[model samples]
Target: MARRGPKSHWWRTRLLAIAIVSVWAVVTLALPFFNSISNGTGPGGVGIYVFMAEGVLVLMLALVFWFARRQQAIDREFAMAEED
Candidate 1:
């Protein structure tokens, strides 16, 4: 039987970031375009400061979670390698 590889690979993190970014990009970028086309200089539906604060909070949360998971994975790997 083949042993399983570590879960926290770079590709996994990158794919996650790409997915989050793609969705965020599509929503943030396209909404304005459609709104402008449909309503002509629509209210942008946003307060810039609130949007900026929320975006930063979400990004920092993701970063912190990722960091914690990575550290756990590293510790697990170190413990396993030492056992061998």
Candidate 2:
């Protein structure tokens, strides 16, 4: 059986964290502009809901990534301990 290295998993988790943060940053910065654009046209209050949803989504994604990284670390530690 072939064994996988923990380094690759660590790098992958790091990349995912970076990507999630980048996306969240972009959305956070752009929300105001988007809200203004939406509010300028009409009385529709949908933009606020959309922004809220996006915020929730980004938070959920961050939470998931955090848990996944934690689980990966635990697994790696267990594997190492088993090998010892």
Candidate 3:
């Protein structure tokens, strides 16, 4: 395998950052578009606004969680993970 150093680590980190930001931006921007399509009551007859809020909140939370885990993995690969 090719040698991995700070340069490689930095490159991987940048890639991960880009990926996370892209996904975040897409989700944030697409929410309204998707909301327009699903504009109606949700389960239990909840209003579209409430449903979209809850869905977007959950999605944002999940995205954050995923980013943390993925970043950690990249850090570990470079022996840069924080000690617990």
Candidate 4:
């Protein structure tokens, strides 16, 4: 079996970071278009604006946590995780 090293780890980390950022950017940029289509109808009859205001915040927080979790897993795979 071929042994991977720091270079491999670095690329994996970079790719994951890019993917996370891309997801965030796409969702944020598409928000306005979705809002326009949905108009004032959202979950529980809430307006798109209201749902977006709260939903975006939640989405951001979720993404942050997701990134942290995934990053930690990558670090562990590379045997570089910090002591906790």
Evaluation by lDDT, superior candidate among 1 and 2: 2
Better of 2 and 4 by TM-score: 4
Per-residue C-alpha lDDT of model 1 across residues 1-84, encoded as one tens digit per residue: 213454544445566567666756765676546555645333544554345447656865776687656645554554433232
Model 1 / residue 68 / CA error / Å: 9.7
Order of the predicted models by lDDT, top scorer first: 4, 3, 2, 1
lDDT of 4 by residue, 1-84 (tens): 223799988999999999998988877888767666867576644666876778888988999999999999888888888889
TM-score for every candidate vs. truth? 0.41, 0.45, 0.72, 0.77
Off by over 4 Å in 3: 1-3, 34-51
lDDT (10s digit) by residue, model 2, range 25-65: 76666765677677745565675766566766776677778
Per-candidate local distance difference test: 0.55, 0.63, 0.77, 0.82
**By TM-score, is 1 or 2 better?**
2
* lDDT top scorer: 4
Collision count of model 2? 0
Task: Report the C-alpha displacement of residue 46, candidate 3, in angstroms.
Answer: 8.2
Best by TM-score: 4
List, residue by residue over 1-84, the lDDT tens digit for candidate 3.
234788998898899889888888877777667666656545534565665678778988998899899888888888888888
